[model samples]
Target: MIRGDLHELNRISWNAATVRHNSHKQDQAGFLRSGGSTLFPEEIELLGEIRGKEVLHLLCNSGQDTLSIAKLGAKVTGVDISDEAIDFARKLSSDSGIVGSFERSDVYPWLEAAIAAGRQFDVVFCSYGALCWLSDLAHWMRDVAAVLKPGGRFVCMEFHPVAMIFDEEGVPKYDYQMPEPLHWDTGISDYVGDSGGALAVSGAENVSEPFVNPNPCAEFPYSVSGIIGAVLDAGLELRIFREHLFSNGWKPYRRMAELPGRRWTMPEGMPKIPLMYGLVAVKS
Candidate 1:
């Protein structure tokens, strides 16, 4: 499929997922009202002390993490492809009294406009399931570099590509070194709220009702070298690269054990695999 068509399909699919994602108790509006953040501990530590910094959050669904960063005293601007997600994010920010800005646009075009407007940020932050949506990592990283000030930092924490090759049954379904984009026509949505339960709160009439997506989506599975090499080629110096054995959410395999922080790992006697990774690079 063409990149534009894939993006549009993903937009629709993600918009559908956003409604359910926002309603879930794990990401409930009230939880955000009480100063809860969706950020993992590793992400928080890597972005240590963002007070008074200008931060750009790419693929910031519903602005949960954006507001969290705002609470840390950073000026934040969140960019997302889904209008519904941005709308809910704006509402959440308003309802929670956290100050931040949001824009609805594909990341590449948004970054291009930011560069044209001479806007630069102290930090460019992205994470979790964000990178897989892009078809061109080099262009993406170049734009990332373009939007950052000299000596600025780019921090990304995401599901490791190695883990993405496995199916729900823990079998390897794709090549870890596959160079092309993968397409999936599965009608099921991957949002946490789809796990089955009533919403934690009511009165979200303005938001769309949750529903399953029947559309297909395409994603590019990039190797660690491909990702890091793109960052380096974009003129950013690598600061840190780390991998973790646990995922950030529910296990893909039923037999896996749940760990603290909503993470999941393999059961006893099973070989451990890196499920998540974080990268920090600086623009020199």
Candidate 2:
């Protein structure tokens, strides 16, 4: 992996270690709002059925999706760098009566260990908001490729880089097309919240440095071509890839009436670019 990528991985590790329990609890509400509704179920449905299939989830913050997949009869194991998130995920599994396993470790090392132990899965699943934290796509892809059994699938549904450019303000000034080189710095931003909105935390209420990480996680933007290339490099062949204007498992803000329940589309006459993309790739 590249030097910058290693730094980013370390940052994520640190963030996972330091993410405040209270803040994480608040964040879990957001995850349920977004993932529970659209991102999680959509990916699960797109994967068809995973009865008795072994699944691996990467960057599985808090493990809601992992547990959800487990509820569908997949023997699920989730790996995340954040200790607090993994703990909450374990609790969620227990509370929900979903049998699953979670591990706190960085992706590369975790996959290496899993491979060494002869671990393989029928599916490797990750989702939106997860990939942006990584610095190197190639290394990440290789790790996802390493622990998969032959014919196993790798599936991901992520917020398009295009969508990421628009912050809570909905400003379009940032470049949405060019994916940049990954870099890291020491800072924290609350991207999701109910009352205060993105990155706005009152001093009295907010935890000091609620999310801690050793590096700045770079948001690497990739075009459809870029995403396709990564999967191919990982010894996976594309089976299904779809870009959608709206996401059913998402709630961007309070005023987004166009996306109420299962609908994911921009208002009429508004620009119709896709907000997210889903991919289903099978091991070759």
Query: What 10-residue stretch in candidate 2 is worst by lDDT?
Result: 195-204
Question: How many pairs of residues in model 2 come into backbone collision?
Answer: 9
After superposition on all CA atoms, what RMSD does each candidate show versus the true structure? 3.6, 5.5
Best by lDDT: 1
- Which stretches of model 1 miss by more than 4 angstroms? 194-211
Off by over 4 Å in 2: 3-41, 177-188, 194-217, 249-255, 262-269
lDDT of each: 0.81, 0.65
Model 2: per-residue Cα lDDT over 1-284, one tens digit each: 44455544555644644354335234343444343422344676677789899988998877766776776678989988766778778776666556789998767777778878988889998886677666667878887887888998998988777765665545564565564644446533443332222222111135334444444545465666667888898888889988877754444433343544444455554576677788998887
Residue 65 error, candidate 1, Å: 1.0
Per-model TM values vs. the true structure:
0.91, 0.76
Candidate 1 weakest ten by summed lDDT: 195-204
Candidate 1 structure quality by residue, lDDT tens digits, 1-284 = 22777788888888877766665544345666786676778899888889999999999988878888888889999999998999998888887888899999988788889999999999999988899888788999999999999989999999898888888778888898776778778632644542222122322232334555776777878899999999999999999999999877645665777776567788898899998999999998
